[model samples]
Target: MKLTLKKGPLYLQVQEILKKRIISGVYPKHSLIPSELELKEEFDVSLITIRRAVEELSKQGYVEKKSGVGTTVLDNHAISKLSKGQRFSEYLIKEGYHLKKEFASLSTINLHEHAADLVEHFGDECYCVERLYTLEEKPYIHFKHYISKEVTLPENTDLLLDSLYEIFFQQGITFNRFKDEFGTEIPDPSIAEILEIEQQPLLQRIRYSFDINEKLIEYSVAYYNTAIHKYVVNFDV
Candidate 1:
């Protein structure tokens, strides 16, 4: 397939194209992908660009490269095991599960002392969005997201129904990296009620997302109902 290459970085665009092909089984598991020369000629891009794109695919577990051989697609199970750290919501969708997010509340609020420390420089105010995540139409998790007011959110946008990162990208706000801390805790009464559980230990994740400039732009706490879903984290040795 010819890539239009009209948007985003050349390498990222190429990566997406190749990833789609692999996921759709166009290039079946263990099948060799086109060579660098072939891909360069096909995309009309430089060898460096093609190499970078392939490297990204390898890092994401879509393909594996071997010396004296070639790049080959990995099986779906292998791919799932190798994706380093994926967003739970995105991961669920990729696993062919129906996922939905419902907003319990969305509003701007004065940041409490605890929240103020999370986004160190965001002053004393921020936007707080509470949401419930459903997997296959059943409650699976709950999330409370606190975003820096400095990062402008689009008015009238349904923060619950849309991908927050996508919305931020549209407004020229993007995260370069994020940090996550995981722990187990008994859910509060309100949280337990939302997750449709009773006196159960929940997996909790505290995530801090930073912009390209390394500024903390978002802080979120998520509680997972492990009875309904499992959280997996992959590490490369």
Candidate 2:
């Protein structure tokens, strides 16, 4: 492995190098990390620096250490890397699957307590919409969108089945995404019913926030079924 510390702290730089290799499959999941003494020489850094780097990697969910068993890379099952400016809808279209949309509901209501804070960030009056997207008749993604009630959308909104952002852009409302978070978990009972998934670990949840005209105006949550699809993201280290 090539190691250089021309920029950033030596230990942080070391951590990035190791993290890149691990995520890129240079070091596969559950594979053992090299001995500290070996890494010390490889990076041409002091042993303390090597140890600190390893510790940092552990904190970031990259690796784990065991007594008398050395360090092991963790399995990163969920897609965690992303290209700088790739759009999920564009990626899906490139895969040759036709995305279809089924609108569930759209209404103005008081924000549920769980989503109150995010709703407040947009505005006191929030409009919510629910939708399900399918690829070639196979149910794919379930999404709920919350936006400022002040911004009037179509009386009957149609999100083009393939791209919600496209509609926003066409309406001259450029979405400003503030947060994007994803994780793996068992499907909620209601979600499981909707997705027809019958077991645990069948779901991937994504929550994001966006601003309109420099004002926070949208918060969205999407649920994806992992049993039928896998996510892949490519990023430059």
Candidate 3:
């Protein structure tokens, strides 16, 4: 309950300590947090410090405070921690590749020809978020994501820096396996600039579908710079 800020700034240290405890199941989801007065005594910190730490957690959707109810822990298994199953980026990072991203667009749009079928599955309600991945600032891949309107996205968030999977996870969505298809192609001018490859550098086109709660909720298409990224998927038996 009490922590000494010995390694980092006081607020960040407080944030991490509380976050670890919450993640460790010390506070289960929907469980009310200790009152502000209780936490002040627990951490021996000023009210201002405790307030700042709690605010940080709130921004990440880890905790909520109601008018009469004390702060409560939000279910966040999907956002804060990666599931036992790995993501493609996680797999790449484990292979020692540096990863970064630049956002291009995140908005709602009418379904287009190529995306029409996908849109129908989601009941014609969709949000498109686009971003370009990079390695140390050089454009390496372009990602376009489509999500159902059932998932509420925070307004004006930067997709390049934020993880879409994490966003959906916090909304109580999870993916087991869907469908994926990949091939090589020449990039259109727009995708070319977004990904920052040569005029034509053997673009790797990948389209993936996600299964959420036995419903197909998302579809995405990505273009990767062949020279910089080696997209690989392994199957066990």
Model 2 segments beyond 4 Å from truth? 1-85, 112-114, 159-162, 212-214, 234-237
Candidate 3: Cα lDDT at 29: 86
Candidate 2 local lDDT, 127-176, one digit each (tens): 77778877777777887788777566666566334344444544445333
Q: Candidate 3 — which pairs collide?
A: none
What TM-score would every model get versus the actual structure?
A: 0.61, 0.54, 0.57
Clashing pairs in 1: none
The candidate, 1 or 2, that scores higher on lDDT is: 1
RMSD of 3: 13.2
Error of 2 at 200 (Å): 3.3
- Give lDDT tens digits, candidate 3, residues 140-159: 77877887888888776564
lDDT for position 165 in model 2: 49
Candidate 1 lDDT score at position 156: 58
Model 1, TM vs. native = 0.61
Best candidate, lDDT: 1
